[model samples]
Target: MNPDIISVVIDKLRKLSPEKASDLTVKNAQFITLQSLDLDSLDTLQLAMDIEDALGMNIEIVNFPATLTIGQLSEHLAEMRAELREPA
Candidate 1:
């Protein structure tokens, strides 16, 4: 995953869950689940929405796996961004 993209995601995560953000780091976040960050379904949904708004893209949540990690999610979003820039 792009480090820049990961940083942006981490910043958004911090805004959404400041309590858990302090403990999160790019290296450790690769293996941690959203649930481990104390984010419930609603929080996750809100996070997704916030990410979309921040990045200005329509990310299909259905494409996300059930057991998603922060690294994987960041990689996926980066891929989606690349796809969007491709000539149609």
Candidate 2:
């Protein structure tokens, strides 16, 4: 998992769920699962949208379900990064 993506996830998640703000650190965000964040459905949806906006990719919730660890989510987004890369 890319540290960059993990940082974005932590930053966005912290802003969305301020109660857990302190806990959502970039270093550990990858180890935690989204389900463990205890966010309501709305927060989760907004987090997805925030991540999409930050990454400039269409992130489907199905592809990045709450069951996935944050590291796994980063892996998914990193795959998107590779897919979107232009030929050089």
Candidate 3:
């Protein structure tokens, strides 16, 4: 996973969920689930949209796994970004 992408994700989380973001660290984000952050469904959806916007790609909401950690989500987004850059 790209560290830059991870940093962007962390920044977005901090902006969108300051309460939960305060308790998070870069290392811990790799193991913590979004559910553990106490984010409601709407918050989670908004976060996804924010991430998608930050990454300049459309993330398929249906394919998102709720159990994915921040690192995993960043890795997944990196993959999606790669796929988009590939020629059809």
Instruction: Give the alpha carbon lDDT tens digit for every residue of 1-88 in model 1.
Output: 7887788778888887898877667987688666667776677777788888888998766644547788888898999999999999
- Which candidate has the top score in lDDT? 2
Best by TM-score: 3
TM-score between model 3 and native: 0.86
List clashing residue pairs in candidate 1: none
lDDT of 2 by residue, 29-78 (tens): 66788888887788788888999999888877777687887778888889
Ranking by lDDT: 2, 3, 1
Better of 1 and 2 by lDDT: 2
Q: What is the lDDT of every predicted structure here? A: 0.78, 0.81, 0.78
Q: Give the per-residue Cα lDDT of candidate 2 at 51.
A: 92
Worst 10 residues of 3 by lDDT: 57-66
lDDT for position 57 in model 2: 88
Question: What TM-score against the true fold does each predicted structure earn?
Answer: 0.84, 0.83, 0.86
lDDT of each residue in 1-88, candidate 3, tens digit only = 6887888888878886787777666788788777677777777788889888888888766545678888888888888888899999
Candidate 3 accuracy as lDDT: 0.78
Question: Model 1 — which ten-residue stretch has the worst lDDT?
Answer: 59-68
On the 0 to 100 scale, the lDDT of residue 85 in model 3 is: 97
- Candidate 2, residue 27: how far the Cα is off, in Å: 2.6
Ranking by TM-score: 3, 1, 2
